[model samples]
Target: MNIIHSAVKRVVKKSLIVALGCAAMLSTTAHASEKVYRLKLAETWGPNFPIFGDATKNMAAMAEKMSNGRLKIRIDSANKHKAPLGIFDMVKSGQYDMGHSGSYYWKGKVPNTLYFTSMPFGMTPAEQYAWFYHGGGMDLMEQVYAPHNLLSFPGGNSDIQMGGWFQKEINTVDDLKGLKMRIPGFAGEILAEVGAKPTNIAPGELYTSLERNTIDALEWVGPSLDLRMGFHKIAPYYYTGWHEPGSELQFLVNKRTFERLPEDLQEILRVAMRTAAYDMYTQATHASGKNWSTIQETYPDIKVKDFPPAVLKALRDANDRLLAQHAEKDEQAKAIQQSQADYLKQVRSWTNISHRAYLNSQAQ
Candidate 1:
């Protein structure tokens, strides 16, 4: 009996030591793993530049919250960085750990980057979101940006943008000839193809240029943002959107910075970005609706118009030709273009049945 009791005591002693040691190891691990990661993000917007700037702030807030303050993102707006359109180069070169900008803005550096943003008469926000999350868009984006050691995610949606504020009526295709307009990206290429002189103008200069007749027309974002820009005050014509049906802004990350993060932190950042992007869409839609109501009530004389069918056909043709040229140049561009076209066909069918049908009935 004495020998058995002694053996039990020894066993208890060993178990206690093992438990204590495990506890100490766990405490040390918890301490060591709590290291904070701080990152700097550059944005292609002025300080507090409404929707665009709000997205960056929203993403940073979400990342910090999700990681319990372990991951903090510092955002530098164009006002601070003095480079509104330099977000891609800044993030790629590690001058900034991340960026908030539109994908098509990098077309000069990487031609295929244009498709990731919205195309003229392309998918709406819902359809595009489906494409990005499910229809193999994320994988295709990986292929495009991997070479640059960068990553791109949909940062936000500006919603369907206004086609432009035209000073005079565009009744026919001939109206576009020599018509100077401020339209950028692949859409600008389309405008040029349609015989319009498409130019890129900085946001700060857009109002003054339009006021001075430096531009006959300019396509900015929709009513949500345009209201504050006072475009309606100067221009009487508020045309419907065809150029940027759903412009998806982008969140770019330095590949090295992304990979070095802890697996959990990486996920935190990813979720934060995605959530913020979707949130921006909702915000934009809401703001557009509210602001449009105000614009109509305040400026009842504003002419809301659509491009003539002939003009649309010309623009559409120009867009198709451009895409064909793009596809012929690169196999990857061909694949991306095909993917978008195929996805749009599939999703638009449902959209017609759901949103279009419902809205039409309500209008009736």
Candidate 2:
């Protein structure tokens, strides 16, 4: 009887061990079979649009290559998404995993977002990049985006954007009175304060509006992008930039989607986005210079002009007051505004001594 009981105990223990081993093996197979993660990105631009469109493509490619097919990104343009301005809501709600658009575009939905793009007479590209990466700009940006279940990063820079293509040259402050222009965001508010009637227009309709006298002036991007719009043909006067000196587009990711990514994948995505952004900036710089040269040589009818001293001063003053109002209303806005101002002051001193001085000397 004792021997039979001992044998029964041994058999039960062996069966239990076998079942546990099978469970472990199944777990290993399940993990190994996990499929590659694919994310969908929505962009604000139309298909094949210039530097802006190229940035997303570059990011997608870099991420896929680095991850060896473990991470794949699919992009949907404005035409496919049919919601150029709706990128914010779509990403936040998880309708899309990512988005590419200007940070300022979300100013209406999220006021603090306005400060992330470019400000009137704000820091240049190099200065802004320093602020974003080195100066707490990234943390502040995260703070602003966190509540919406999103993360934001600098997508690219347009360098110094041209002020606008004006049908009539702006010679005096008076020239802005009742001027109907397709200007948006904080800049549009400043223009309104200065007696210009600011309006918003879809990018595709900008040319037809300007040509048919529906709008008097419009600022797209720099020469890299403006030449294709043919704004110079209709509006003979090209103005130097003031509002968006370093227009920075934003890359947005759904926080939930980001959190689910493996650690290696998360790092790969960050590096890819940063590289693509820097590459786009380089591309923009080259394209702007090359296209500007083309305009000078081929489009003799297009005249370049700068805002008069008095008008510039007025713009600066109006912008200051507007920012003051913004800062007063929101504590986050005040903090971001001050941080950017402080960072710009520190960097501009060096910029003035180096790039500015060198360029000024070259012009002589």
Candidate 3:
């Protein structure tokens, strides 16, 4: 009985030691795995653009929170770290760890980037998001940015926007000729094709330029933001339907910076961006609706009208021609355009049945 008791004691002692060793190893690993990275994030807009600016802040906050404070992002607004349009290049060249801005602004460098932002009569915000998330649009965009040593994710989305606020009524295509307008990307190109001189102005200068007659017209954003900027006071003719269709904001990261992140941190960034994308669209839609009502109530003199059918047709035709021209000049543009067309075809098939049915019911 004594010999049996001694053998059992030895086995019990060995088991306890093994368990204690495992605990010690686990504690050591937990201490060793703690990681911290301070990321510099840049934005091309002021704090006044809450949906855009605030969403970026929220993204940073989410990353910190999800990573348990291991990752910190410091955001610098335009002119603080770099110029507004210089964001993509700044991130690509590793001058900035990350950047938040409209993808269309970089069309000169990568024509395909414009599709990720807006196109003449392109998809609405929800549809565009669907394309990006499920329709393989995100993968395609990553491919386009791969060569630039950057990776971009959808940060926010401004739902369908308003057309420009014109100083004088644009009743015909002829009136657009020689009109100096503040616009960007494909819309700017289309404006040029129609003989209007398109100018790219920073957000800060938009109101002053319009008030001082530096620009005959300007398309800044939807009604909410436009109202805040007081564009209606300068140009009272508010047109319907944005030339941009759905303007999507992008968050760009240096490829090397992204690759250096832990797998969990990478996921935190992507999921946070996806969440921000939805939140931004929701906020913009709500704000736009409220602001639209306010505009009608307070600014009785402001005229809201739809673009003439002829003008719309002319613009659409011009867009097609410009897209074709771009495809011929840029191989990357051709690939992106083809990918978008194919994905859009599939999404439209589903949308025609689901989205169309809902819209038709609304009309009823």
Candidate 4:
């Protein structure tokens, strides 16, 4: 009897220990399963910025779907949470986890930021993407953002943009003198040197400002957005050629927040952005062609003109001077410019053979 009782006691103790161990393991698993991360994203543009807004929203949707609802993102548009231009700083400070805006908008903080946007007479969407993805542009861009506590990804490209809208015909560079125009980044600086006063206005206020005669000219995106905003109704004269060759938008993430994500999640974000970038370019290009067709069909009263040779020459000269001045003051600007120039030279070689040949054939 004594032996049997001792055996029984040992069995009970072992059972208890086993049960406790199982309970601890289950608790840890449950805690991990319950953990969820929420990312807050902000953007300066409104919902109407065409591919910019559409691609951003699509990214959030894709993230949630890909994570199977494990990760969530909350996006705030301009003035929804923070001011438009405040997005870069907000994300950098970790006040926000993510931001979407044109890199050129932040050129004030980092002059080199303009290189990631569009340069005067710069490469088109295909050429720019080649430079960025395969030509060391991404690595160089990362270096530029490192000091700002941010990580950036290519968001979207605006393809080729229109010159601008003018209240009065700009037959010569002399017409630009004293013209108050809404432009931004290096383009704005170039305009200033040529005697046009550049102003940065939010999208929503653009129409009112132009209608009220507060601005003499404005350059938004292309005809699609400009037509939607009634820019043609107010500023009847539209000019095209080399003002903003191709504008690229960027998705910026807080460096700390980005580092905190799991490796798998990080990869998901990257893949999602890359997909978004491609989709944006495709959609913008298609929409631009359709919109141009519509403008010819519908807005027959509107006059479309190209920048005269003399005006283009003056603008190009001014842009060169502005770039040199900024590069002298900022080392990063010099580095990025050099990288872009080198990348363009290589891409242009192939593009001249392939893309240019194709375009020329079509024209013929």
Candidate 5:
């Protein structure tokens, strides 16, 4: 009995030592991981702007949660920053550690920035995303932004955008001539090529501009956002989208800030941004579906028309010519354009067989 008792005591002593060692290791790890990183972000949208603003909030939340509180992000909207169009400069100069805006908005400052956003007649959301992740799109984007001390990522997608709200129907190519439209980026350039005067206006001023004849027509987003803007009240014609089919917004990070982050935190930010982008796309799709139904029920007088074939052809020709000119002027532009074109052709064939075929079969 004495021997058995002694053996039990020895086993208990060994177990206690093992338990204490584990506790010590856990305490030391907790101390080592206590460091926290905080970042500030500037967004182009006003405070609490629906789909766009939600993206930044979602991304911040995801980063904080995924990093177990090691990373935190604070967001300031355009109203706080007071410069919606200056996101590129703000992030590049490190005035803001990060920014959320459209990549194309910086075309004037960096011509290559134009390609990151949706092209005039580019791939759909799925195709574009595949191109970015698998077809070398992300690498090209990095090449374009790296020189400016900024890192850009896909922030969100607004799905397919509508062409615009017009006071009158555009029946022919001539109708576009001398037309004053509120468009932006490469699409605006294409309009200019076709003799239309295209201008960019702030979101807050769009309604007033169209109502007071400051602009003849303007394209906001699709039904997801447009219904709230009340553009239908002033302009009865809503043309279908052709310009930004898969409009992807961007998140810009300062290079110095990004490099300062630990590798794990850096990966957390990337994953957060990507997940938030997809969330925004799904949200946009849901909102557009709901709002489109609402429009049909509430505003039956709204005329939905497709651009005439002649106008489409003219626009396509203008797009090709502009692209050729850019390609001729810059070798990088040529490479990026070729990359996009090749990827589009490769994926679009499958898309026709899978998506297009399925849709047509269902319709029939």
Candidate 6:
């Protein structure tokens, strides 16, 4: 009887050992399957660039943390890549997995892309965010970029960009005629329609171009960023914004690279990009308020001006004509234009009742 009981105990112990070994093997297999994915990102901004650079770092950190090191993003700024404006082509060609740049920067390469960035006399930041997320903006954006083997996401917003710092005040429409300025995208086209010689200079060269009189005026960003660029020291006239009420930067991803990422990692990337974009907007707003206060206190000589009513009307008319010409040329352009106009019309009405009304009440 004792021998039989011992035999039964031995069999039970052996069975328990086999079950534990199987469990350990399964755990090891699951861990081994969580493969690590690393991506390279190219940014238009230089190394240590303030608000713009911060967005990329924030995105990378979030993705890494959320993914538990399974996903890693390495960013190379303009300093390293030596091609601030070439980001679109680089990512499309798969030289880099991702890129951070303004969608309007590629307007010369892809005309339809000009619509993705802020438009002249367009929606504010909040309104534009609504358009991108809730409206048909994302679908339209995908249609435009997918053919190029890339995916685009909103990188950040610079808030309402201040109109360019000017060597002289813009008193009339003629002032814009023969005016040499560094502006890009659809806004540049509008300036050309009004006889201004609009050009695009890289961000690094903007100060030198304006300082050496290579360009008579230039708009960088609002007080949030422009203050550091030292534009106020040279150009006394700082005009209010008419163009780029909501200047959104872009993130471009190689579609093939994105597709290779696991489902969990893809969602993590999307959430990280989205959160970084919103964080950038808030940072811009905060920095603008702080910097503007500093400018008012320290730089009393800086003259803030608004374009004359007549000049504004001429620019607005020119904007209408140019957009019409683009719409006439491409069905895609027409669709995007219609979508933006409709969304603006719908959202602006609510904005008028809410934000606009509230601001007016507070001012009184």
lDDT of all predictions, in order shown? 0.92, 0.92, 0.86, 0.85, 0.94, 0.95
**Predicted candidate 6 versus true structure: per-residue lDDT over 117-150, tens digit per residue:** 8999999999999999999899999999999999
Predicted candidate 5 versus true structure: per-residue lDDT over 1-364, tens digit per residue: 9999999999999999999999999999887687899899999889999999999999999999999999999999988999988899999999999999999889899999989889999988999999999999999999999999999999899998999999989999888888999998899999999999999887778999999998899998899999999999999999999999899999999999999998999999999999999999999999999999999999999999999989999999999999999999999999999999999999999999999999999999
For residues 78-192, what per-residue lDDT tens digits would candidate 3 score against the true structure?
8587487789888988989999998889888887888888777777777788888888788889988999999999988888888989999988999999999999988999999
Best by lDDT: 6
Q: Which stretches of candidate 4 lie over 4 Å from their true place?
A: 1-34, 47-49
Candidate 4 local Cα displacement, residue 204, angstroms: 1.1
Task: Report the candidate with higher lDDT, 2 versus 4.
Answer: 2
| TM-score (C-alpha) between model 6 and the true structure | 0.94
Error of 3 at 184 (Å): 0.6
Candidate 4, run of 10 with poorest lDDT? 43-52
RMSD of 6: 2.5
Worst 10 residues of 5 by lDDT: 29-38
Residue by residue across 294-344, what tens digits does model 2's lDDT show? 998999878898899999999999999989998899899999999998998
Better of 4 and 6 by TM-score: 6
TM-score of candidate 4 relative to the true fold: 0.91
- RMSD (CA, angstroms), candidate 3: 3.0
Span of 10 residues, lowest total lDDT, candidate 1: 198-207
Q: Which residue runs does candidate 2 get wrong by more than 4 Å?
A: 1-34
All candidates in order of TM-score, best leading: 6, 1, 5, 2, 4, 3
